[model samples]
Target: MNLDREVIKALAPTGVLRASINLGNPILANTSKSTGEPEGVSIDLARAFAQHLGVDVELVVFDAAGRSVQAVASEQADIGFFAIDPVRGAEIAFSAAYVLIEGSYLVREESPLLHNDEVDRDGCLVAVGKGSAYDLFLTRELKHAHIVRAPTSPTVVQTFLEQELDVAAGVKQQLESDCRKHAGLRLLPGRFMVIRQAMGVPKTRGAGAARALHAFVEEMKDSGSVADALQRHSIEGASVAPNEA
Candidate 1:
């Protein structure tokens, strides 16, 4: 059967949502190195959601995760796809999480930090994305480490590449993706935090909109569509958790 027309119409005019881009993982960004267009997991998921509603998609790109959420809060876009944190949930309505993630640190393979818990010892420079969950975790847990906040994940990666920091922390997927792209970078074993990634809708959009979108996501999960999408995109370490709604 055809999906709801109203939902499709709501998305049709511009057919795009503003998304945060990570240059480290071109696959997750849905980027075509040749065409300069989005092509990865987020793009596929967002496009499928739009297509189910019978609409095309337009992808607006933002360089930082913080700005991605801000785009939705500012009504610069309809929704955002990223990791959902309790703090961000308080500011924006979140759909049921479609992916599970863990936090980890990326460091040079030869760095002493790779072998010691003392990596977080006093005066060690750790790079993290500003306003990101990793930054939040560092503030609370890595008290001895001198945290250096980068505005974006790519920048954090760049800083670490430049040997300017002892560690760069972020989602495990992102860290692994970086490791594959850059030699001599390795991810630490233990996770700092477990995360669930979801779509974010603006708070000002009202409860009904949030409910509708949440229901749509729930339906996708229940029907195994979300799992299929994850597999289709070859996303590793992602699974849909049980949803109350």
Candidate 2:
């Protein structure tokens, strides 16, 4: 468990590991209903990273994943947790994913879109959280349906309900929970995309830091820390991501 001093210094230049947590992605992080503080698998992973480096963890919280990415890109945060996306790769160096979450669509009970394939049609308005992995993926892939942007991923379900959108795209678990809380809502049969939840550092952090971060992730996954964190948080609908070669 020996850590390189140079890697730690580069990853946490201020003597503390400032990790950006995205509150928008429920699969990774959310406000604790009891404590109202950020808690979840991502939080655990952040703490683990800092502990391995013998540094204190300072969570830089954001309401959306995009903001977390921006924090890392701007060097405001030493590290961040995010879904691996090509658009974000320009500024952040990503480690192998430690968790895999599903992206799915939700529709009103009476909506005729019974399947994922049926969602891409003219006259259908799809609501998605702006800057979410689903939004980015759908933006590039969807050819017909118009995408309506919501403020954040956690609010996409509400946006769908409020706007009466033909479809809503977001984390599968969040959508499922929303469907349970509200009537006349239903999730599609299968997922549209698989979100690879990974750790990231600013590209300016250097190749050594990136390699160290990547190694840290591999060790966490190999040691079962990622799986344990998911279980500790009582998270469902997500599994530990496979080790990268």
Best by lDDT: 2
- Which parts of model 1 are misplaced by more than 4 Å? 1-28, 52-56, 114-120
Which regions of candidate 2 deviate over 4 angstroms? none
* Residue 73 of model 1, lDDT score: 73
Model 2, span 50-73: residue lDDT tens: 998899999999999888889999
Q: Write the per-residue lDDT of candidate 1 for residues 1-245, one digit (tens) a residue.
A: 24354544343335554334433333356457788776666676677666665555567677677777777777777777767777777778888876677778888878776543666798888888887767766787776889888868667787766766888888678788789988888887787677677777777766655666677777778888777777786778756767857
Per-candidate clashes come to: 6, 0
Error (Å) of candidate 2 at residue 229 is: 0.8
